[model samples]
Target: MRDSFHHRLDVLVLQLARMCDLTAVAMSRATDSLATGDARLAEGVVADDVIVNQTRTRIEQDAQTLLALQSPVARDLRVIVTVLRSAEHVERMGDLAHHVALAVLRRHPDPVLPAPLRSRFQLMGSIAVRMAGTTGKVVRERDPVLVRTLDAADAEMNELHRSLFQVIGHRWAFGIPAAVDASLLSRYYERFADHAVAVAARTAFIETGTPALI
Candidate 1:
């Protein structure tokens, strides 16, 4: 019974990790679609949002089951708690992707980012992808050190976000509609990165037994 129960818990963790990967892939694709002005890709990303949400719901249900059945303790309990929280963050990340896809579809029946801003958004997407990748690793390996590296990555994201604002405010002169769209897109991307950092912080806490906020 104990062995079977432990196996169930293991399955729960793996499922949660898979959900993160799916969410990351969706976000990466969404951002790429935006950068490249690929309407097809944007449509695909938007379609995948439902699957991501389902995966998140499944993870939450599984976590609740494990908690009720296994009665995990100490480190085990922490792992379950982290899984629950991480799943929520992952779902939100997926939602961010959907938001980007909708923005692309709305702004560009044939969407293309302004040339100057493309590279910056691309870099921000890269950071978000890296965060998702790192969080997956931390979950699988329980590596506190990798989580710390994710913290450093978050710093770079902040710098990029600041640079984006400076560039947009000074370099481009857009009409009101374009300006509003650009601003909202930038904010969404930055906030997505922030949530990724939060996931990494929680992973680090689970691994290191320290709740050091990043």
Candidate 2:
């Protein structure tokens, strides 16, 4: 009986980790659509959000069910809580992806980004996607060292985001539209990476026997 219960619990955790990976991929697609002005890709991203929402709901339900049925203790309890929190992170990541798609749709086929600004935005998005993938890996493997490595990569994204803002402030010569759009895209990428880092930190805590602040 004990073994079966833990087996189910591990399956649930793995499912949530997979959901996080799917959301990260969706976010990457959304950013690509934005950078390339690919209307088809943007539309595809918007359409695929249904899967993200459904997966999040199912993961939450599973977490609740496990908690109620098993009355888990210690590490089991921590795993349940981590699964719940990770679901939220994955759902929010999907929302960010949709927002990026909407930004692309809003701009339509027109070149929505300035050359220099788009270049920087692309760099930021790439880093954010990579960090998100790392977060998923950390959760799946329960590796504290891998999580810490992701944390470092996340710091680089933060620096890039800050530098992007500085460039926007100084590049007044590019006019208001350029600065505003660049700022919006940078904000999205920054928030995405921040959430990824949070996931990594939380997963690290769960795996390493560290206390969760939540």
Candidate 3:
């Protein structure tokens, strides 16, 4: 029974990694759609969200089942709890990516970001993708040192998010509509990074038993 429980735990980790993989793909295509005015890629991300949502549901159910059946205590219990919470964080990352895609669809023929803000958004998207990829690895390995890098990357992402406001501030030539779109897109990237950080923090918690400030 103990070996069976451990096997299920390993399976849970793999499932979480799969969900992270989906999020990374969603965010990557979302940025591409945002950058190139490609409505098709944006639509594809929106369609893929159903899978993300389903994965989250499955993860949560499996965690609950393990809790009921295994009656795990101490470290084993912590691992299951972290898996449950991290799944929600990953699901939110997917939703943030979906929101970015929706913005692209809304402005289909027209590009959502102004010329001045395009490069900034691209960087933010890159950071988001990197953070998400790292998050998946952290979930699998639970390496404390590996998780700390996510904190550094998230700080960089926050700075980029802050800098975007300067461009979108007063003396804006693109008008109100563009400003709104840029603001929302910047926020999406920021929150996407935040969720990635949250998942990493949860992975850290599994081993350290210390909750992260994030």
Can you give the TM-score per candidate against the true fold?
A: 0.91, 0.92, 0.96
Candidate with better TM-score, 1 vs 2: 2
Task: Please provide, for model 1 over 1-53, each residue's C-alpha lDDT reduced to its tens digit, 9 standing for 90 to 100.
Answer: 56976677678778877776877798799889888888889999999999989
lDDT of 1: 0.79
Give me candidate 2's TM-score against the actual structure: 0.92
In model 3, the Cα lDDT at residue 80 comes to 92
Q: What is the clash count for each candidate, in the order shown?
A: 0, 0, 0
> lDDT of each prediction vs. the true structure?
0.79, 0.79, 0.90
Error of 2 at 101 (Å): 1.2
Give the Å error, residue 132, model 2. 1.3
Q: Please name the candidate that would achieve the greatest lDDT relative to the true structure.
A: 3
lDDT of 1 at 159: 83
Residue 144 lDDT in model 3?
79
Which tens-of-lDDT digit does each residue in 84-167 have in candidate 3? 988989999999999999999998899998777878888898889988998899988888787889889889988988887787
lDDT of 2 by residue, 1-214 (tens): 5598888787877887787787778888887887789989889989998898898898889889999988998888988888888788777887888888888888887756776667677777778778778878888887877777876777887888788767767635777775777777777777887787777777777766786453
Comparison by lDDT, 2 against 3, better one: 3
Return the top candidate by TM-score: 3
